[model samples]
Target: MLLPTTLILLASLVQAATLTLKNSRFNITSKDATELRAEPLSVTEKLSSPLKLDRTDILRLTFQVVEKDNGNNVQPHQAFLRFYDETTDEEGIQPVRVSNTGKGKFELNMAKPPTSLPPTGSAPLRVSLLIGSFVHSPLKVELFDLHVPASHPPAQHTEEASYHPLPPLGHTFRPEQKLPPRIISASFTGLALAPWLVPLVLWGKVAPSTPRLFSPHILPFVTTLALFEGLLFWYWIDLRLGQVLLYGGILALPTVFAGKHALASIGERRLGLARK
Candidate 1:
């Protein structure tokens, strides 16, 4: 009577509740701990699972089920998998309807479908497992903190067709390696002083309000350009921007250049070296 209804209600509630914030009752370890718990948003509450894209790479997801069963013994069954992203919905996330074959410890030949970087991070190309409208586990496949060279499909050429341009090899910088607050504040202090220093060093005539010569907005824009973009270009050469001193030096280049030009323009006028 009420018992059957109660079980169904309980199961549905459990299914809807989010899971990632909770303790992972089951342990999911891999040969390489490159990707840990990353799941699709829809089923993120059910399971924090990993996915296997290449036919050879293995997917190992472990979970804990309630011991008591209402009707069927809780066993792994054939569930539909949808290769989808944020815009994709429950209906749209359906798999390409190809065969998994599920042979040899569940070997899969699925390709990691295209995905956009997350709003806050680059952890994309996620994976999820659906179980009767109850998508259990979801996993986010991340190669590593260090960017690895990704392989692309071979180009098709018939001698007449134009060759397609290669994708950008932009690497992600880990946020964990950001400068500490004290260091960041000190760095800003230096960048703030750049404009005035340029005038002083070149012409030896400091502006009356040299400290506050430029508008406030200019400082942050110059500093950000100096720090992030400069560092990126510096690292594109494959230099280890991870180290503190080297990274700082690389980022400082743009700021220095800006200040230098500012000096030559204004400083020369003050020194009577050139026209204002």
Candidate 2:
């Protein structure tokens, strides 16, 4: 009889230990349907309740919960906090017993700090609240705790350090639609066929003094016409609009180059003046 009793007690202890070891939880069922609030207001990380701490530091937290539907129904609840630095995870809290406060008010304190210095950092220290009576197993109970300062005992190197990577910025992304490759292939083909089409297609040239990229008058007109026609064609054309396309596309690259050079030249002039 004594040996069987010992085995049963050992099994119960093991089950309790397993429950305490669990760090993540999300159930927030309330016994009393009242307004309950968790402090620090971040809703960041969570863990399950009835959690045991290998070690715990002193923690302090306060709650100010009023009725969500009416101002007159102001009822305060109490909770206990328990943290084991030996068990560290600050993602969130899980409630074993939510809304365990029996009366309209209550308070609680844990036995020790939940963690060592390196584990507790500056996070809201977790606490488990055992509101109302410890007896009857309190079927009507409310529980919640605030982030108190976890007293992490000091040691070597830096305590409470964490790492996370920052997301990159800007649109340097390219789709693998073969658009660029096709465009490049077409460009090379155009260049290869340029000598053959020069006299046959673009049979004229502006004066020698006129810059090729910014040929005083015609380049701007040609560039603008090319843009207008290209846009129109892209929007509505079912087949290639050769005359309008050549008119516009030829000037597109040159117009852009001229504009860039203009900006560069102006910047250089301003920089020179500033230096002087």
Candidate 3:
């Protein structure tokens, strides 16, 4: 009972550890000689204390953009967050593009921190918002919140720090829940083949002959299998839409031919038996 209880408590702590931004507000826009600009607004609390980060933590950032006017006259504006080293005055990490997430909201994630840095006593990082373009009407943009998970304690110094590739952006793993190979295979099979079921059944009923549930139409079967293999290869190689469609069309031709021939063969067999 003690072991199980301890495990449950550990899991709860893992889920609850997250650091969030406390202060965020939009300031005024300015113009210098040629074009207008919006100064980067400070989002986090003052730099008196160091922000803690865990090795396996993901940085979650949220932004809100409210267009002052709804009319088409207002030109589009782009916003981005730049992370900089306060001491060195350089880019601390890769800049994240702010994307509109409907209903006057935008969000960005630092899925993986570009590189690990040496430990610092004071807040060593600062973030700023950059707006690209002149705005006649005010576009109210502000960083809503920022959150990072609290996990493995900060390392003592630069020599011992190590960072691994981050897991898929928003996924968390649990120890007790078991996922086996057979279950995974079944899931993948269901996902891949389920979409064709209704259409395949309808095709079988409307065809000239009773369709063969499993007939050895050698050529068509082999062709369809090869085409499917090619499709999978092309998809994994490039993961592009054009190539997927090209291979999908090629795969579809062989599949249709196989189905039609297989059904015809089954129909012929049934008719022969009926005459006998």
Candidate 4:
């Protein structure tokens, strides 16, 4: 048990080691492969002068990770180059590809810059290196400042104007139709109702006898027919077609049975008179 405890303590100490960089360097070149600027980078200090680049320039950086205690090469789980613009507060992070031997390389071609590069203006961007690992302490080193040409404004979409809110709608309606004069309306109404008087006058003149109208056999049929007429009148006045149809259907069953019975009774009475 004592030996196991000692080994665990040794392992923890090894895992807590700090990381550093070695042989770090960067260079800028023109489109024709002419070396424009070259410098060795220091892990503890920043460059005194900011780097400048043109539209067709290329920048290349190389470095190696190592343990601070023994100066032995070591690979970190994550390595990134960060570019930040102080004036705009915009930052971009670009990953650095490192090999198993801790050698890392990064390249930026201004002709076709990566999307991770932040938008630039007159102000220079602060450059920094970041290294992180689960087994080792994290490391961050300020590298230098960079200046590039100002970026052009992004192009607008052809239909971008449609995205804005539309103006409030203004509706126009014609005035309500004017009604005809009251006297003319009254005259037309009277004319329409004048024909109904003919039947009433004929009814009064004939005074036809209807002794069986109130009889139980005939009363139901007559009442059902009168109700049917009343239902239609109600429909014209206020009730909808659906209401009229419903009431008429409910009244129809009785109407049919009553009509059948009344007809049958009249036939019997006629037969008796004929036999006598």
Q: TM-score for each prediction?
A: 0.21, 0.17, 0.26, 0.59
RMSD (CA, angstroms), candidate 4: 6.4
In model 1, the worst 10-residue window by lDDT is 140-149
Residue 187 lDDT, candidate 2, scale 0-100: 94
User: Of the pair 1 and 3, which is ahead by lDDT?
Assistant: 3
* Candidate 3 local Cα displacement, residue 236, angstroms: 93
Question: Which residue pairs in model 4 clash with each other?
Answer: none
Tens digits of per-residue lDDT for model 2, 12-129: 6533331011112222212342223332321133433332222222222343332222322222232333433334554223222323221222222234322322345544444443
Once superposed on the true structure, which residue ranges of model 2 sit more than 4 Å away at CA? 1-79, 83-119, 122-124, 132-135, 139-276
**Candidate 1 C-alpha lDDT tens digits along 1-276:** 999999989887655543221111222223454544344222234333433233223343333222122322233233334333333221113322212222112122223322321211122234444433243343222211211123342234475345667687999987776566998889999999889867678675553555534645345445656577656776776667466466677657766776666656566557884443
Model 3: runs farther than 4 Å from truth?
1-50, 68-76, 92-95, 99-111, 115-123, 136-276
Tell me the lDDT of model 1 at 77.
33
> Model 1: runs farther than 4 Å from truth?
1-58, 64-72, 75-77, 85-123, 133-276
Per-residue lDDT of model 4, residues 93-182, tens digit only: 999999989999999999999988888889998999999988888999999999988776434659978999999999889999987899
**lDDT (Cα, 0-100) at 169 in candidate 2:** 72
Worst 10 residues of 3 by lDDT: 28-37
Best by lDDT: 4
Model 1 scores a C-alpha lDDT of 0.41
- Residue 119 of model 2: what lDDT? 40
Every candidate's lDDT: 0.41, 0.41, 0.47, 0.91
Better structure of 2 and 4 per lDDT: 4
